[model samples]
Target: MKPWLVVAWKEIFESLRDRRTLLTSLIIAPLLGPVLFSGMMQFTLAKENKDHEQRVEAGVLGADHAPQLLLWLQAQGLKRVPAPATESLVTAAVRNSQPKIVLVIPADYGEQLSAGKPASVKLYVDTSDSDARRAGERLQRLLAGYAAQTAALRLMARGIDPSIIQPVVTDEIDVSTPASRAQALLGVLSYFLLLSTLVGGMYLAIDATAGERERGSLEPLLALPVSRDALVAGKLLATMVFAAASLLLTLVTFIVALRFVPLESIGMSANLGPLVALQLWLSLLPFVPLAAALLTLIASFARSFREAQSWMTGVLLIPTLPIMLAVVAGLKPTSALMAIPSLSQHFLVSRLLRDEAIPLPEMLLSVGGTLTLAALLSALVVALWRHEKLLG
Candidate 1:
């Protein structure tokens, strides 16, 4: 057997024999995001269903001025309660949360309507609630609709054409694709995926390098007839496998859960297919090697397990940098866009979400460049593996 293959097989065996660590990585694979996302989607769905069922309990002050309008409110499915007489009473009801919204008609409500002037109807709603805002908007719109209908009737009664008074009707146009719609939304998927992958590899990296050294097994393994380069190569290959496994497992769970989630019914625009998800994972492969190499080097430099785990946390935080960039920059993925590290992957996934194609040549360059960096890091690790201080 080749020396590199021999060391790689040994490390792979060592990695497997630690059943506790293997189980831990496996457990983390599906648990982290699936549980969180399911709960979040459930919560959002519950909120949407709850808000839809709300009957906008409204408080009305003036009964005499618009008895017809009060009946209109009742007809619109808004449950009306009599508002308090004074401003103080309205303020009290608002503070106590007894009324979700209140409407006040001024003393001159009839006079303004008779004079063809706009009448003031104050709507005090719980601004803290977005649902309340929508409800209030609907109430205001329904009031305007009633006014328009009444205006048409009045003009027709006066032997005037209603069409002359209302000349223009507006039709809205919205131009957004599946990808652009996803762009408009913030997917918790990206954050959780990034976090899970980084943290998932943490224990594995610690065990693969620092744990081996602390247990005094790494030196003997290094003492084997195999060259240091082969030993480093083999160990790196094993670590990469574990990282990729953790990442893949996480990806599969999330993809399955996303497919099962009722996102459209809940008023969100996200489509998570197996293909798009696989692309996302593929984009992260370079990062896995980079992460493993970084963690391994850090662990190799650290004198103790305590030091290794502590230092590796900072290693775990590096992916968050790209997350911040992707968010602030709002980058759209393109062909040459892959030249950027975190941005490239982010754009690639975002583009896929946007239902855009990942350019083949760009994908090759970015993935190739990222892998090249990982290779250089491997060489650096081999050099560190030969260092007397790291081994001793």
Candidate 2:
């Protein structure tokens, strides 16, 4: 048998024996991808459907001034409850049960409106609550219309044209594509995929390098007739296979989870088909070598598995830099940006997600560049393995 196969089979058997790693690699990681995606879909669907609600459960502190208006609002799906004695009580109830909106109406609301001397009423709303905020906006529109009708009625009694008082109008049009509309939401998914891929492989990479070194097996393995290059190649191949497998598992689960969702609710055109999702998996393939080779090389440099684990944990964090930038700046996937490790996957996956055809040339460039980097790193690992201090 080839030494590399022997190494691979040995490592695989050892890894299989460690039930925790086996469970994490095969079951936990796979399930996590679906659970993560499904959770996000549920949250988004809940948020989007909240607006189509039949009624807005509102609490008012100063309904006395607009009792009639409040009654009218109730007729229009706006149910008002009297405010509780304390805000904390309201918040606690809101946290536990059905939706609640606490509206604090300032004192002296009716007197100022009746006086007609620049009367102003203050309304306190929970901006953090989407339901509350939507209710607030709807209520504001209702009040504005009420005020306008009231003004017109008063003016008509005096025989004045209220139309002249409000001649201008404001209008808005939304021309955003569904994909572009979901940019922030999609950007979040990109971050998650990056995280799932990078952190997912950290354990395997740490084990392949540091674990081997610590187990006293690395020195004897190096003493065999097999070249250091072959050994490094075998190990690098093993780690890449592990990372790629985990990444592929997550991508598949996430796609399956998305299938249960109504994509239109989140401003996406539709759920991805098997082909498009498969494309996304292929797009992330390049990152396999990038992540594994990078992490394995870095971990191999460490003296101990724990030490390597510590260092790679921080290295695993480096992707957040580009991810956050992509989120805030709304990055476009241009050709020049394809070589940036995790960022490359982010760009390509997002593009492939929408079923957009990635140019062949650009795809080759990314794949080629990543493979070259992987080769260079594997060569470096071999060099390290050849060293007395580093390997022994």
Top TM-score prediction, candidate number: 1
The local distance difference test score of each candidate is 0.72, 0.70
Cα lDDT tens digits, model 2, 38-104, are 7786787687777766576767766666676667777777776656765456666555433356555
- lDDT comparing candidate 2 with the true structure: 0.70
- Separately for all candidates shown, the number of backbone clashes (residues 3 or more apart, or on different chains) is 1, 0
In candidate 1, which residue ranges exceed 4 Å CA deviation? 45-57, 63-65, 81-85, 92-98, 126-129, 163-168, 175-186, 264-277, 334-337
Cα error of candidate 2 at position 234, Å: 0.5
lDDT of 2 at 331: 73
**After superposition, candidate 2 runs with Cα above 4 Å error:** 52-57, 84-119, 126-135, 152-166, 177-183, 262-270, 360-365
* Model 1 worst lDDT run, 10 consecutive residues: 178-187
Candidate 1 per-residue lDDT over residues 94-212, each given as its tens digit: 65666767888777888887787877788887777776677787778777877888788778989999888777888988676544654444355665665666566666677767887
Could you tell me the lDDT of residue 348 within candidate 2?
Answer: 74
Q: Give each model a TM-score.
A: 0.83, 0.82
RMSD in Å for all candidates? 3.5, 4.1
Q: How much is 31 displaced in model 2, in angstroms?
A: 1.9
